[model samples]
Target: MTHSLEEHGTEREGPLSLQEIDEIIGTENPPLRNLRITYAYHQLAVALARLLDDRNATWCGFGTWASRTAGLFIRGELKPRPVGLPPVPPWVSRHLMTWAAPHVGSNVARGNLLVFQELGPLFHTMVTAYTEEDDAERALERVLQPLRPGLVTEGGQDLLIAAARSYHRAMPLPHSAARSQVILLANLQVALHEQIRLQEAIAASLAPPLRAPFTPAPLNVLATRFWGRLATSHLMDVYMPAVDFTTTRTLIPLRLGRDVGGAHGATTFCEHLTDLIDLELKALLYDFDRSPNSVLGSAAADWSLLAERMNYLTDFFRLWQQDPCLMQAPFTPRQAEDLRAGKMPSGPPL
Candidate 1:
């Protein structure tokens, strides 16, 4: 749906600047900007994966120079288009750029995490190679090269970071009841991580001389702490209900017990109990699946474990509402009276 709303997804010939991003992507809003950033991270991940697979790069050490412009290319370009997944719009330009302020800010936070959590470890694991390394230029190349074939082209990464420079500008919270409500809720959770990067950027930009006893790397450390706090906050805090509210509301189901008389009460009870039991069993299985990886630290490995869990649930829940055999109770007399006469009865199920 968003393919055309973009201006460009190319790499700059030289070091990236924010204006170039605004120009290339027409920095108007969130989705367009996020698409750019997400593309960049996806590219980085692939580049690292390639390095991880390389013999010379085995000891960690990859950087921007390794890759170059390929733009929003996907796995299959020539063959007949695949059937299922929604194709990226042919040109994602237009007012979509307006969504960038918040989207870019959010992804930038995650991008920082990807860099520190994933890339930094590669360096640590392969530190011996890093210590002996000389050509900083080659080091950057080595890092970025593997990503050459993936989704983000060199130009694209440059453009995204460039566009992201305007992130400090706030997304004018829309006055519309629908949009503002979402922003107010999402801001609470998202702000914590986003602030992490800002603090670090400021500290580094103003950091003192050659060797002062460091208090910490400002932005990243704060990011680390903020993430710690986020685990305790409920998911409702982190994402706007409206983001996936349609899907979520469908998944949770509504059972108006009071309205739906006693005739079907036993049926509903059995169904809810069965669904919960199944859910518990699924959770247990995933818990076990993660056990082996507890001691093994690799993104691919961790992703594989989590992916299995995600895939399993995605399928299980997709059909849960339409589940053929599941039983549910019918309406009670008062509920039926309200329904027949047309009254908005309160509670989940009707």
Candidate 2:
């Protein structure tokens, strides 16, 4: 049997008052109660996507609702009921009541997805701070306490503890050799610990990953939740193109006749620094997809390594940004032009 927002009896449009939104979702029908609650979550996600785009969106309030509701959902105690939301942005409110559309269960999932996106900025800041400090417990509390409230539902109290465990499982202190010097890299490691917590909360709300018919792709769903746009634009606009000019046309055609040790030298360098960057981005996408349900898997370990690599790469990229000339890598002199290419060397010379 198919269920929908209208069949659940919600008013499509009029005013964006939370009260009106409240009414569309509030009801005594036991059979439709869950559907109503999920619909409310969907509308809220749509509203939030609009607000986040505004430079003046009220994040603190959004954080409050997200934290409390996230806590509720995590604890499995979320009631299909109205929420005491902070006042909606006047412009947003003005149009919300006039808003009407077909809705689906995935909207609720998208709402949860938006919560992930909305929380990202705060997450970045918190992770930065968490990684710098040596004391784990103190750092965890310093960050966690601010978000904690008396109303955090079931199992919410244990989230930080679980994340901390995952952090240690993946990243033991005293730092790995690869992670020792770079603070940015270290910060990413610390940040993942917190990300684990957020992922856990979301996953608890969306288990087994159900997909509604004609729903958006998972990456698109996540991207839109955060940026209200597609992933391609988000990545391309924000990230520099992955290219390694040092190795550009580094490969040469030799009919056993081309001058030996000439041009790119006898050494055949088939790889470019860009390849590493692309690999990292791919790894990141993989991690993002897995993060939803990765409380216990090898995700912690994978993130730990990726964070270290990202740190080093970030520094490398930033250095190039400061002085573009810094990226002109000198070609290595190879002794013999062997036809068979060997294993691509790992780790940048940086």
Q: Identify the leading candidate in terms of TM-score.
A: 2
Per-residue alpha-carbon lDDT of candidate 2 for residues 20-76, written as tens digits (9 for 90 to 100): 333423433322333233233333322322222111112221232223233223233
lDDT values of the candidates?
A: 0.25, 0.28
How many steric overlaps are in each model, in order?
A: 42, 4
For every model shown, what is its TM-score relative to the native structure?
0.20, 0.22
Instruction: Name the TM-score of candidate 1.
Output: 0.20
Error of 2 at 218 (Å): 31
Tens digits of per-residue lDDT for model 1 on 1-350?
01110111111112222333333244333323323333332233233223222111111111221111111111111121112212223132112222222332343333333333333332322222323457543444443443223112221233222111111111222323232222212221122222232344323222221233565678655543332222111110111011122223222211111111111122221222222323323343344323221212111111112333222222222212112211111223343234223343344422
RMSD in angstroms between candidate 2 and the native structure over all alpha carbons:
24.4
Model 2 weakest 10-residue run by lDDT: 229-238
Candidate 1: regions farther than 4 A off = 1-26, 54-195, 198-232, 236-350
